[model samples]
Target: MRQSSAVFRMIAPLIAVGVLMVGCGPSPAPNSAPSLSPMPVPAQTAASDKPLRVAPAPSALTPPVGSLYKNPTNNRNELVLADVRHTAVIIGDSQAMPAGSWPQQGVAALGYKLHVAGMGGTGYVAGNGKTGNYIDALQRGDWVLPYGEPPLIVIEGGGNDATQHATDAQITSNADRLLAALKTRYPGSRLAMIGTLARGINNGGGRRTEVDALLGRIAAKHGVPFVSAGDWLTRYDAIGDLQDGVHLRPAGHAKIGVVLAQELTALGLAARPDSAPAAK
Candidate 1:
Protein backbone atom coordinates (compact mmCIF):
# COMPACT_ATOMS: atom_id res chain seq x y z
CA MET A 1 0.00 0.00 0.00
CA ARG A 2 2.91 2.37 1.00
CA GLN A 3 4.80 1.64 -2.33
CA SER A 4 1.65 2.29 -4.34
CA SER A 5 1.16 5.67 -2.58
CA ALA A 6 4.82 6.88 -3.32
CA VAL A 7 4.48 5.87 -7.03
CA PHE A 8 1.17 7.77 -7.20
CA ARG A 9 2.82 11.00 -5.82
CA MET A 10 5.65 10.97 -8.49
CA ILE A 11 3.07 10.34 -11.29
CA ALA A 12 0.84 13.18 -9.99
CA PRO A 13 3.66 15.92 -10.57
CA LEU A 14 4.40 14.56 -14.11
CA ILE A 15 0.68 14.78 -14.99
CA ALA A 16 0.55 18.39 -13.69
CA VAL A 17 3.66 19.37 -15.79
CA GLY A 18 2.20 17.76 -18.90
CA VAL A 19 -1.07 19.67 -18.41
CA LEU A 20 0.91 22.99 -18.01
CA MET A 21 2.91 22.32 -21.21
CA VAL A 22 -0.33 21.65 -23.11
CA GLY A 23 -1.88 24.97 -21.77
CA CYS A 24 1.25 27.07 -22.80
CA GLY A 25 1.40 25.73 -26.39
CA PRO A 26 1.13 28.47 -29.09
CA SER A 27 -2.53 29.59 -29.18
CA PRO A 28 -4.39 28.79 -32.41
CA ALA A 29 -4.69 31.84 -34.72
CA PRO A 30 -7.44 34.03 -33.29
CA ASN A 31 -10.80 33.60 -35.05
CA SER A 32 -11.42 37.37 -34.70
CA ALA A 33 -10.98 39.79 -37.72
CA PRO A 34 -7.39 40.82 -38.79
CA SER A 35 -6.09 44.41 -38.12
CA LEU A 36 -5.01 46.71 -41.04
CA SER A 37 -3.72 50.36 -41.38
CA PRO A 38 -5.62 52.93 -43.49
CA MET A 39 -4.26 53.89 -46.90
CA PRO A 40 -2.91 57.48 -47.40
CA VAL A 41 -4.39 59.96 -49.94
CA PRO A 42 -2.53 62.59 -52.04
CA ALA A 43 -3.11 66.28 -51.33
CA GLN A 44 -4.87 68.40 -53.98
CA THR A 45 -3.26 71.36 -55.80
CA ALA A 46 -4.83 74.48 -57.40
CA ALA A 47 -3.42 73.44 -60.76
CA SER A 48 -5.45 70.25 -60.57
CA ASP A 49 -8.67 72.16 -61.21
CA LYS A 50 -7.48 74.54 -63.96
CA PRO A 51 -6.11 74.22 -67.48
CA LEU A 52 -2.83 75.88 -68.45
CA ARG A 53 -3.00 79.50 -69.59
CA VAL A 54 -2.16 80.28 -73.22
CA ALA A 55 -0.94 83.44 -75.00
CA PRO A 56 -3.50 85.71 -76.61
CA ALA A 57 -4.39 85.09 -80.25
CA PRO A 58 -2.29 86.92 -82.82
CA SER A 59 -3.79 89.81 -84.79
CA ALA A 60 -4.55 88.86 -88.39
CA LEU A 61 -3.62 92.09 -90.15
CA THR A 62 -0.44 92.93 -88.30
CA PRO A 63 2.65 91.00 -89.27
CA PRO A 64 4.55 89.89 -86.24
CA VAL A 65 7.00 92.64 -85.33
CA GLY A 66 10.64 91.98 -86.23
CA SER A 67 9.40 89.61 -88.92
CA LEU A 68 11.18 89.40 -92.26
CA TYR A 69 9.23 90.34 -95.41
CA LYS A 70 10.34 87.92 -98.09
CA ASN A 71 9.36 89.60 -101.36
CA PRO A 72 7.01 87.57 -103.51
CA THR A 73 8.73 89.10 -106.54
CA ASN A 74 12.45 89.74 -106.60
CA ASN A 75 11.99 92.65 -108.99
CA ARG A 76 13.17 96.10 -107.81
CA ASN A 77 10.68 98.21 -109.73
CA GLU A 78 10.15 101.85 -108.78
CA LEU A 79 6.47 102.69 -108.24
CA VAL A 80 5.69 106.30 -109.06
CA LEU A 81 2.87 107.90 -107.05
CA ALA A 82 2.65 111.09 -109.11
CA ASP A 83 -0.61 112.98 -108.64
CA VAL A 84 -0.15 116.46 -110.05
CA ARG A 85 -3.44 117.39 -108.40
CA HIS A 86 -2.40 115.76 -105.08
CA THR A 87 1.35 115.17 -104.86
CA ALA A 88 2.55 112.61 -102.34
CA VAL A 89 5.34 110.03 -102.37
CA ILE A 90 4.86 106.61 -100.76
CA ILE A 91 8.02 104.61 -100.21
CA GLY A 92 8.26 101.53 -98.03
CA ASP A 93 8.38 97.73 -97.84
CA SER A 94 5.57 95.43 -99.05
CA GLN A 95 3.23 96.53 -96.25
CA ALA A 96 3.81 100.09 -97.31
CA MET A 97 3.15 99.10 -100.91
CA PRO A 98 -0.39 97.86 -100.30
CA ALA A 99 -1.12 100.31 -97.52
CA GLY A 100 0.10 103.13 -99.76
CA SER A 101 -2.06 101.75 -102.55
CA TRP A 102 -5.14 102.55 -100.49
CA PRO A 103 -4.25 106.22 -100.57
CA GLN A 104 -3.33 106.02 -104.23
CA GLN A 105 -6.63 104.37 -105.10
CA GLY A 106 -8.49 106.97 -103.12
CA VAL A 107 -6.73 109.72 -105.01
CA ALA A 108 -7.49 108.04 -108.31
CA ALA A 109 -11.10 107.49 -107.35
CA LEU A 110 -11.24 111.21 -106.61
CA GLY A 111 -9.72 111.84 -110.09
CA TYR A 112 -6.35 112.81 -108.67
CA LYS A 113 -2.88 111.25 -109.10
CA LEU A 114 -0.41 110.33 -106.33
CA HIS A 115 3.01 108.84 -106.85
CA VAL A 116 3.84 105.58 -104.98
CA ALA A 117 7.56 104.75 -105.03
CA GLY A 118 7.41 101.66 -102.84
CA MET A 119 9.72 98.66 -103.19
CA GLY A 120 9.13 95.38 -101.44
CA GLY A 121 11.56 93.78 -98.95
CA THR A 122 13.29 97.08 -98.48
CA GLY A 123 15.18 98.17 -95.35
CA TYR A 124 16.26 101.60 -94.17
CA VAL A 125 19.81 100.37 -93.64
CA ALA A 126 22.15 99.96 -96.62
CA GLY A 127 23.57 96.60 -97.89
CA ASN A 128 20.58 94.24 -97.53
CA GLY A 129 20.22 93.12 -101.17
CA LYS A 130 16.46 92.93 -101.58
CA THR A 131 15.33 95.62 -104.06
CA GLY A 132 13.31 98.55 -102.81
CA ASN A 133 15.66 98.69 -99.87
CA TYR A 134 15.14 102.28 -98.74
CA ILE A 135 18.76 103.09 -98.06
CA ASP A 136 19.91 101.98 -101.49
CA ALA A 137 16.87 103.35 -103.30
CA LEU A 138 17.11 106.68 -101.55
CA GLN A 139 20.81 106.93 -102.39
CA ARG A 140 20.08 106.20 -106.04
CA GLY A 141 17.86 109.27 -106.68
CA ASP A 142 15.03 106.99 -107.83
CA TRP A 143 12.43 109.14 -106.12
CA VAL A 144 13.93 112.52 -107.13
CA LEU A 145 14.05 114.39 -110.45
CA PRO A 146 16.74 117.07 -110.55
CA TYR A 147 15.27 119.11 -113.40
CA GLY A 148 11.67 118.99 -112.15
CA GLU A 149 10.46 120.48 -108.90
CA PRO A 150 11.29 118.09 -106.02
CA PRO A 151 8.14 116.21 -104.96
CA LEU A 152 7.33 115.28 -101.38
CA ILE A 153 9.35 112.20 -100.39
CA VAL A 154 7.49 109.87 -98.02
CA ILE A 155 9.85 107.26 -96.57
CA GLU A 156 8.47 103.99 -95.16
CA GLY A 157 10.76 101.15 -94.01
CA GLY A 158 12.08 99.33 -90.88
CA GLY A 159 10.14 96.06 -91.07
CA ASN A 160 13.04 94.33 -92.78
CA ASP A 161 15.49 96.10 -90.51
CA ALA A 162 13.71 94.78 -87.44
CA THR A 163 13.60 91.28 -88.94
CA GLN A 164 17.30 91.44 -89.72
CA HIS A 165 17.87 92.10 -86.02
CA ALA A 166 19.11 95.63 -86.66
CA THR A 167 19.90 97.17 -83.30
CA ASP A 168 17.88 100.07 -81.93
CA ALA A 169 20.88 102.36 -82.28
CA GLN A 170 21.37 101.19 -85.85
CA ILE A 171 17.75 101.89 -86.74
CA THR A 172 17.92 105.30 -85.12
CA SER A 173 21.19 106.16 -86.76
CA ASN A 174 20.06 104.93 -90.17
CA ALA A 175 16.84 106.95 -89.93
CA ASP A 176 18.77 110.07 -89.02
CA ARG A 177 21.18 109.56 -91.85
CA LEU A 178 18.36 108.91 -94.32
CA LEU A 179 16.52 112.04 -93.24
CA ALA A 180 19.68 114.10 -93.44
CA ALA A 181 20.46 112.72 -96.85
CA LEU A 182 16.95 113.41 -98.09
CA LYS A 183 17.08 116.96 -96.82
CA THR A 184 20.48 117.59 -98.33
CA ARG A 185 19.66 115.99 -101.68
CA TYR A 186 16.16 117.39 -102.14
CA PRO A 187 15.77 120.51 -100.03
CA GLY A 188 12.26 121.31 -101.29
CA SER A 189 10.78 117.86 -100.78
CA ARG A 190 8.70 117.19 -97.66
CA LEU A 191 9.83 114.10 -95.71
CA ALA A 192 7.65 111.70 -93.77
CA MET A 193 8.36 108.34 -92.13
CA ILE A 194 5.66 105.76 -91.56
CA GLY A 195 5.58 103.43 -88.52
CA THR A 196 5.26 99.66 -88.74
CA LEU A 197 1.90 97.92 -88.75
CA ALA A 198 0.97 95.73 -85.77
CA ARG A 199 3.37 92.80 -85.50
CA GLY A 200 2.13 89.21 -85.30
CA ILE A 201 3.50 86.07 -83.57
CA ASN A 202 6.17 85.78 -86.25
CA ASN A 203 7.54 89.04 -84.99
CA GLY A 204 8.77 88.60 -81.49
CA GLY A 205 6.84 90.99 -79.30
CA GLY A 206 8.47 93.98 -77.57
CA ARG A 207 10.84 94.32 -80.53
CA ARG A 208 8.12 95.84 -82.76
CA THR A 209 7.19 98.19 -79.95
CA GLU A 210 10.83 99.14 -79.77
CA VAL A 211 10.95 99.78 -83.52
CA ASP A 212 7.74 101.85 -83.47
CA ALA A 213 8.97 103.93 -80.56
CA LEU A 214 12.23 104.54 -82.35
CA LEU A 215 10.31 105.62 -85.46
CA GLY A 216 8.36 108.11 -83.36
CA ARG A 217 11.58 109.53 -81.97
CA ILE A 218 13.08 109.81 -85.43
CA ALA A 219 10.02 111.60 -86.72
CA ALA A 220 10.10 113.97 -83.76
CA LYS A 221 13.82 114.58 -84.12
CA HIS A 222 13.43 115.56 -87.75
CA GLY A 223 10.34 117.68 -87.04
CA VAL A 224 8.54 115.66 -89.68
CA PRO A 225 5.22 113.79 -89.65
CA PHE A 226 5.18 110.24 -88.30
CA VAL A 227 2.18 108.13 -89.20
CA SER A 228 1.52 105.26 -86.79
CA ALA A 229 0.07 102.50 -88.96
CA GLY A 230 -0.11 100.26 -85.93
CA ASP A 231 -2.84 102.52 -84.55
CA TRP A 232 -4.45 103.37 -87.87
CA LEU A 233 -4.64 99.79 -89.21
CA THR A 234 -6.85 98.59 -86.33
CA ARG A 235 -4.94 95.34 -86.78
CA TYR A 236 -7.05 93.39 -84.34
CA ASP A 237 -10.19 93.95 -86.36
CA ALA A 238 -8.56 93.60 -89.78
CA ILE A 239 -6.29 90.64 -89.12
CA GLY A 240 -7.88 88.75 -91.98
CA ASP A 241 -6.62 91.42 -94.37
CA LEU A 242 -3.14 89.82 -94.34
CA GLN A 243 -2.29 87.14 -96.89
CA ASP A 244 0.62 85.31 -95.24
CA GLY A 245 0.72 86.67 -91.74
CA VAL A 246 2.50 89.79 -93.00
CA HIS A 247 1.56 91.29 -96.36
CA LEU A 248 -1.88 92.79 -96.82
CA ARG A 249 -4.49 91.40 -99.16
CA PRO A 250 -6.05 93.67 -101.82
CA ALA A 251 -8.98 94.47 -99.55
CA GLY A 252 -6.75 95.18 -96.55
CA HIS A 253 -4.73 97.47 -98.75
CA ALA A 254 -7.87 99.45 -99.68
CA LYS A 255 -8.93 99.93 -96.07
CA ILE A 256 -5.58 101.30 -94.96
CA GLY A 257 -5.28 103.41 -98.11
CA VAL A 258 -8.53 105.23 -97.35
CA VAL A 259 -7.42 105.86 -93.78
CA LEU A 260 -4.07 107.08 -95.05
CA ALA A 261 -5.69 109.45 -97.50
CA GLN A 262 -7.89 110.88 -94.77
CA GLU A 263 -4.85 111.34 -92.57
CA LEU A 264 -2.94 113.01 -95.40
CA THR A 265 -5.87 115.35 -96.10
CA ALA A 266 -6.00 116.19 -92.40
CA LEU A 267 -2.28 116.97 -92.39
CA GLY A 268 -2.65 119.28 -95.40
CA LEU A 269 -0.73 116.79 -97.53
CA ALA A 270 -3.87 116.16 -99.61
CA ALA A 271 -6.99 118.21 -100.37
CA ARG A 272 -10.50 117.49 -99.06
CA PRO A 273 -12.40 119.13 -101.92
CA ASP A 274 -15.80 118.25 -100.40
CA SER A 275 -15.24 119.17 -96.76
CA ALA A 276 -15.39 122.80 -95.61
CA PRO A 277 -12.22 124.24 -94.12
CA ALA A 278 -12.10 124.49 -90.32
CA ALA A 279 -12.08 128.00 -88.90
CA LYS A 280 -8.44 128.86 -88.16
Candidate 2:
Protein backbone atom coordinates (compact mmCIF):
# COMPACT_ATOMS: atom_id res chain seq x y z
CA MET A 1 0.00 0.00 0.00
CA ARG A 2 2.83 2.47 0.79
CA GLN A 3 4.65 1.90 -2.56
CA SER A 4 1.37 2.35 -4.48
CA SER A 5 0.68 5.74 -2.70
CA ALA A 6 4.18 7.13 -3.64
CA VAL A 7 3.91 6.12 -7.25
CA PHE A 8 0.40 7.69 -7.51
CA ARG A 9 1.75 10.98 -6.06
CA MET A 10 4.60 11.19 -8.71
CA ILE A 11 2.25 10.35 -11.63
CA ALA A 12 -0.39 12.94 -10.46
CA PRO A 13 2.25 15.78 -10.46
CA LEU A 14 3.44 14.82 -13.98
CA ILE A 15 -0.19 14.80 -15.36
CA ALA A 16 -0.86 18.36 -13.93
CA VAL A 17 2.35 19.71 -15.58
CA GLY A 18 1.35 18.15 -18.93
CA VAL A 19 -2.10 19.74 -18.75
CA LEU A 20 -0.54 23.22 -18.06
CA MET A 21 1.86 22.79 -21.06
CA VAL A 22 -1.08 21.93 -23.39
CA GLY A 23 -3.08 24.99 -22.25
CA CYS A 24 -0.10 27.37 -22.99
CA GLY A 25 0.59 26.04 -26.58
CA PRO A 26 -0.40 28.39 -29.54
CA SER A 27 -3.73 29.56 -28.00
CA PRO A 28 -4.99 32.23 -25.58
CA ALA A 29 -6.55 31.49 -22.22
CA PRO A 30 -10.32 31.15 -22.43
CA ASN A 31 -10.96 33.87 -19.76
CA SER A 32 -8.40 36.46 -21.11
CA ALA A 33 -8.85 39.38 -23.75
CA PRO A 34 -7.25 39.25 -27.30
CA SER A 35 -4.25 41.53 -28.21
CA LEU A 36 -4.40 44.12 -31.13
CA SER A 37 -1.83 46.02 -33.33
CA PRO A 38 -1.97 49.81 -34.20
CA MET A 39 -3.18 50.89 -37.72
CA PRO A 40 -0.56 52.27 -40.23
CA VAL A 41 -0.57 55.89 -41.54
CA PRO A 42 -0.82 56.69 -45.30
CA ALA A 43 2.02 58.45 -47.24
CA GLN A 44 1.69 62.10 -48.44
CA THR A 45 0.63 62.79 -52.09
CA ALA A 46 2.78 64.56 -54.85
CA ALA A 47 -0.02 67.11 -55.40
CA SER A 48 0.91 68.76 -52.07
CA ASP A 49 4.40 69.57 -53.48
CA LYS A 50 3.09 71.66 -56.45
CA PRO A 51 2.83 75.51 -56.51
CA LEU A 52 -0.56 77.28 -56.18
CA ARG A 53 -1.99 79.21 -59.14
CA VAL A 54 -2.36 83.01 -58.80
CA ALA A 55 -4.43 85.48 -60.91
CA PRO A 56 -2.70 88.25 -62.93
CA ALA A 57 -3.24 92.02 -62.65
CA PRO A 58 -5.21 94.26 -65.04
CA SER A 59 -3.31 95.68 -68.07
CA ALA A 60 -3.25 99.38 -69.09
CA LEU A 61 -3.48 98.48 -72.78
CA THR A 62 -6.96 97.11 -72.20
CA PRO A 63 -9.22 100.00 -71.15
CA PRO A 64 -11.58 97.68 -69.33
CA VAL A 65 -14.23 98.49 -66.76
CA GLY A 66 -12.90 100.71 -63.94
CA SER A 67 -9.97 101.82 -66.12
CA LEU A 68 -8.79 105.45 -65.97
CA TYR A 69 -8.87 108.00 -68.82
CA LYS A 70 -7.42 111.44 -69.49
CA ASN A 71 -9.20 114.26 -67.68
CA PRO A 72 -7.86 117.69 -68.81
CA THR A 73 -9.99 119.67 -66.36
CA ASN A 74 -7.56 119.17 -63.47
CA ASN A 75 -4.86 117.98 -65.86
CA ARG A 76 -5.22 114.49 -64.35
CA ASN A 77 -6.50 111.17 -65.63
CA GLU A 78 -9.71 109.85 -64.04
CA LEU A 79 -11.93 106.76 -64.23
CA VAL A 80 -13.98 106.29 -67.37
CA LEU A 81 -17.06 104.60 -65.93
CA ALA A 82 -19.63 105.52 -68.54
CA ASP A 83 -20.18 105.81 -72.30
CA VAL A 84 -18.53 108.82 -73.97
CA ARG A 85 -20.73 110.12 -76.78
CA HIS A 86 -21.73 113.69 -77.59
CA THR A 87 -18.22 114.79 -76.66
CA ALA A 88 -16.22 117.31 -78.69
CA VAL A 89 -12.47 116.72 -78.75
CA ILE A 90 -10.28 119.84 -78.46
CA ILE A 91 -6.57 119.72 -79.13
CA GLY A 92 -5.19 123.07 -78.01
CA ASP A 93 -2.76 124.80 -75.66
CA SER A 94 -2.96 126.88 -72.44
CA GLN A 95 -6.09 128.54 -73.80
CA ALA A 96 -8.05 125.26 -73.49
CA MET A 97 -6.49 123.94 -70.27
CA PRO A 98 -8.99 125.42 -67.79
CA ALA A 99 -12.14 123.60 -66.66
CA GLY A 100 -14.16 126.67 -67.49
CA SER A 101 -12.11 127.60 -70.56
CA TRP A 102 -13.71 128.93 -73.75
CA PRO A 103 -13.76 125.55 -75.53
CA GLN A 104 -15.43 123.78 -72.59
CA GLN A 105 -17.81 126.68 -72.11
CA GLY A 106 -18.77 126.78 -75.77
CA VAL A 107 -19.27 123.00 -75.91
CA ALA A 108 -21.22 122.95 -72.64
CA ALA A 109 -23.50 125.70 -73.94
CA LEU A 110 -24.14 123.52 -76.98
CA GLY A 111 -24.93 120.56 -74.67
CA TYR A 112 -21.72 118.70 -75.45
CA LYS A 113 -18.94 117.47 -73.22
CA LEU A 114 -15.46 118.85 -74.00
CA HIS A 115 -12.56 116.39 -74.03
CA VAL A 116 -9.26 118.35 -74.23
CA ALA A 117 -6.04 116.74 -75.45
CA GLY A 118 -3.70 119.75 -75.49
CA MET A 119 -1.95 121.54 -72.60
CA GLY A 120 -0.08 124.73 -71.78
CA GLY A 121 2.99 125.42 -74.01
CA THR A 122 1.86 122.79 -76.58
CA GLY A 123 0.78 123.31 -80.20
CA TYR A 124 0.75 121.74 -83.67
CA VAL A 125 4.54 121.89 -84.00
CA ALA A 126 5.56 122.63 -80.38
CA GLY A 127 5.57 120.47 -77.23
CA ASN A 128 6.15 120.74 -73.49
CA GLY A 129 9.32 119.00 -72.28
CA LYS A 130 7.31 116.10 -70.92
CA THR A 131 5.14 115.61 -74.05
CA GLY A 132 5.57 115.54 -77.82
CA ASN A 133 4.06 117.97 -80.29
CA TYR A 134 0.44 117.47 -81.41
CA ILE A 135 1.28 115.20 -84.37
CA ASP A 136 3.82 113.18 -82.44
CA ALA A 137 1.46 112.87 -79.48
CA LEU A 138 -1.33 111.55 -81.71
CA GLN A 139 1.01 109.06 -83.38
CA ARG A 140 2.55 107.88 -80.12
CA GLY A 141 -0.84 107.39 -78.40
CA ASP A 142 -0.06 109.97 -75.70
CA TRP A 143 -3.72 110.97 -75.46
CA VAL A 144 -6.53 108.54 -74.67
CA LEU A 145 -9.01 109.16 -77.43
CA PRO A 146 -12.67 108.72 -76.58
CA TYR A 147 -14.45 105.55 -77.79
CA GLY A 148 -16.79 105.92 -80.78
CA GLU A 149 -17.17 108.92 -83.10
CA PRO A 150 -17.20 112.34 -81.47
CA PRO A 151 -19.35 115.10 -83.00
CA LEU A 152 -16.65 117.73 -83.44
CA ILE A 153 -12.85 117.72 -83.32
CA VAL A 154 -11.30 121.20 -82.90
CA ILE A 155 -7.60 121.96 -83.37
CA GLU A 156 -6.75 125.03 -81.27
CA GLY A 157 -3.13 126.11 -80.86
CA GLY A 158 -0.51 128.34 -82.52
CA GLY A 159 0.63 130.54 -79.64
CA ASN A 160 3.44 128.13 -78.78
CA ASP A 161 4.49 127.66 -82.41
CA ALA A 162 4.47 131.44 -82.85
CA THR A 163 6.25 131.97 -79.51
CA GLN A 164 8.99 129.61 -80.64
CA HIS A 165 9.01 131.36 -84.03
CA ALA A 166 8.27 128.14 -85.97
CA THR A 167 8.30 128.87 -89.71
CA ASP A 168 5.07 128.70 -91.73
CA ALA A 169 6.44 125.64 -93.53
CA GLN A 170 7.11 123.81 -90.27
CA ILE A 171 3.68 124.72 -88.91
CA THR A 172 1.92 123.70 -92.13
CA SER A 173 3.74 120.36 -92.37
CA ASN A 174 2.95 119.27 -88.83
CA ALA A 175 -0.57 120.68 -89.05
CA ASP A 176 -1.13 118.73 -92.25
CA ARG A 177 -0.01 115.48 -90.65
CA LEU A 178 -2.23 116.02 -87.60
CA LEU A 179 -5.20 117.02 -89.75
CA ALA A 180 -4.75 113.99 -92.00
CA ALA A 181 -4.64 111.66 -89.03
CA LEU A 182 -7.77 113.23 -87.51
CA LYS A 183 -9.60 113.01 -90.84
CA THR A 184 -8.70 109.38 -91.24
CA ARG A 185 -9.44 108.36 -87.64
CA TYR A 186 -12.57 110.48 -87.28
CA PRO A 187 -13.84 110.48 -90.85
CA GLY A 188 -17.44 110.74 -89.64
CA SER A 189 -16.70 113.74 -87.42
CA ARG A 190 -16.59 117.42 -88.41
CA LEU A 191 -13.21 119.19 -88.10
CA ALA A 192 -12.68 122.83 -87.07
CA MET A 193 -9.92 125.21 -86.01
CA ILE A 194 -9.72 127.85 -83.23
CA GLY A 195 -6.87 130.20 -84.08
CA THR A 196 -4.61 131.80 -81.47
CA LEU A 197 -6.37 134.22 -79.15
CA ALA A 198 -4.73 137.58 -79.69
CA ARG A 199 -5.21 141.37 -79.80
CA GLY A 200 -5.58 143.47 -83.00
CA ILE A 201 -2.74 145.16 -84.93
CA ASN A 202 -3.24 148.38 -82.91
CA ASN A 203 -3.36 146.54 -79.54
CA GLY A 204 0.22 145.18 -79.23
CA GLY A 205 -0.58 142.11 -81.33
CA GLY A 206 2.56 140.77 -83.02
CA ARG A 207 3.43 137.17 -83.89
CA ARG A 208 0.24 135.90 -82.25
CA THR A 209 -2.01 137.78 -84.72
CA GLU A 210 0.20 136.76 -87.62
CA VAL A 211 -0.07 133.07 -86.60
CA ASP A 212 -3.84 133.45 -86.10
CA ALA A 213 -4.24 134.88 -89.63
CA LEU A 214 -1.98 132.15 -90.97
CA LEU A 215 -4.16 129.44 -89.32
CA GLY A 216 -7.26 131.04 -90.84
CA ARG A 217 -5.68 130.69 -94.26
CA ILE A 218 -4.70 127.10 -93.46
CA ALA A 219 -8.26 126.33 -92.36
CA ALA A 220 -9.53 127.67 -95.70
CA LYS A 221 -7.08 125.43 -97.54
CA HIS A 222 -8.17 122.37 -95.51
CA GLY A 223 -11.88 123.16 -96.00
CA VAL A 224 -12.27 123.15 -92.21
CA PRO A 225 -14.36 125.81 -90.45
CA PHE A 226 -12.25 128.37 -88.55
CA VAL A 227 -12.93 130.69 -85.61
CA SER A 228 -10.39 133.51 -85.53
CA ALA A 229 -9.82 135.19 -82.19
CA GLY A 230 -7.06 137.32 -83.76
CA ASP A 231 -8.83 140.64 -83.15
CA TRP A 232 -10.89 139.42 -80.16
CA LEU A 233 -8.89 141.37 -77.52
CA THR A 234 -9.74 144.55 -79.40
CA ARG A 235 -13.15 143.50 -80.82
CA TYR A 236 -14.44 142.62 -77.33
CA ASP A 237 -12.37 145.45 -75.79
CA ALA A 238 -10.86 142.76 -73.52
CA ILE A 239 -7.26 144.02 -73.40
CA GLY A 240 -7.55 144.43 -69.64
CA ASP A 241 -8.79 140.82 -69.35
CA LEU A 242 -5.32 139.40 -70.07
CA GLN A 243 -3.96 137.85 -66.88
CA ASP A 244 -0.44 137.73 -68.29
CA GLY A 245 0.74 138.91 -71.72
CA VAL A 246 -0.94 135.75 -73.12
CA HIS A 247 -3.30 133.71 -70.91
CA LEU A 248 -6.73 135.07 -70.00
CA ARG A 249 -8.44 135.48 -66.63
CA PRO A 250 -11.78 133.87 -65.71
CA ALA A 251 -13.77 136.85 -67.02
CA GLY A 252 -11.91 136.71 -70.31
CA HIS A 253 -12.58 132.99 -70.63
CA ALA A 254 -16.25 133.62 -69.95
CA LYS A 255 -16.42 136.39 -72.54
CA ILE A 256 -14.65 134.32 -75.17
CA GLY A 257 -16.82 131.33 -74.38
CA VAL A 258 -19.99 133.35 -75.05
CA VAL A 259 -18.58 134.84 -78.22
CA LEU A 260 -17.48 131.47 -79.54
CA ALA A 261 -20.82 129.92 -78.63
CA GLN A 262 -22.61 132.63 -80.62
CA GLU A 263 -20.29 132.22 -83.55
CA LEU A 264 -20.76 128.44 -83.53
CA THR A 265 -24.51 128.90 -83.40
CA ALA A 266 -24.40 131.21 -86.45
CA LEU A 267 -22.24 128.70 -88.29
CA GLY A 268 -24.90 125.97 -87.56
CA LEU A 269 -22.34 124.07 -85.48
CA ALA A 270 -23.60 124.68 -81.93
CA ALA A 271 -26.15 122.22 -80.48
CA ARG A 272 -29.76 123.35 -80.82
CA PRO A 273 -31.41 122.46 -77.54
CA ASP A 274 -34.85 122.89 -79.16
CA SER A 275 -34.08 120.23 -81.79
CA ALA A 276 -32.36 116.86 -82.10
CA PRO A 277 -28.53 117.12 -82.10
CA ALA A 278 -27.00 116.36 -85.53
CA ALA A 279 -23.37 115.96 -86.74
CA LYS A 280 -23.61 118.75 -89.33
In order, the Cα lDDT scores of the candidates are 0.59, 0.78
lDDT of 2 at 83: 46
Residues 64-113 of candidate 2: C-alpha lDDT, one tens digit per residue: 64566554433434445354556778888888888998877876787777
Please provide, for model 1 over 1-280, each residue's C-alpha lDDT reduced to its tens digit, 9 standing for 90 to 100.
9999999998999999999999888655876433467454444567695555555567653334333333223222222223332454556666655534554554344334455664666667633464535655655645432222234556766667777788888787777887886676556666666677665334443455567668888899889877666444344455678788656778877877676656655655543353544211
> If scored against the real structure, what TM-score would every candidate get?
0.57, 0.70
- Candidate 1 Cα outliers beyond 4 Å, as residue runs: 1-86, 98-100, 103-112, 126-132, 140-147, 199-205, 231-236, 271-280
Regions of candidate 2 where Cα sits further than 4 Å from its true position:
1-81, 272-280
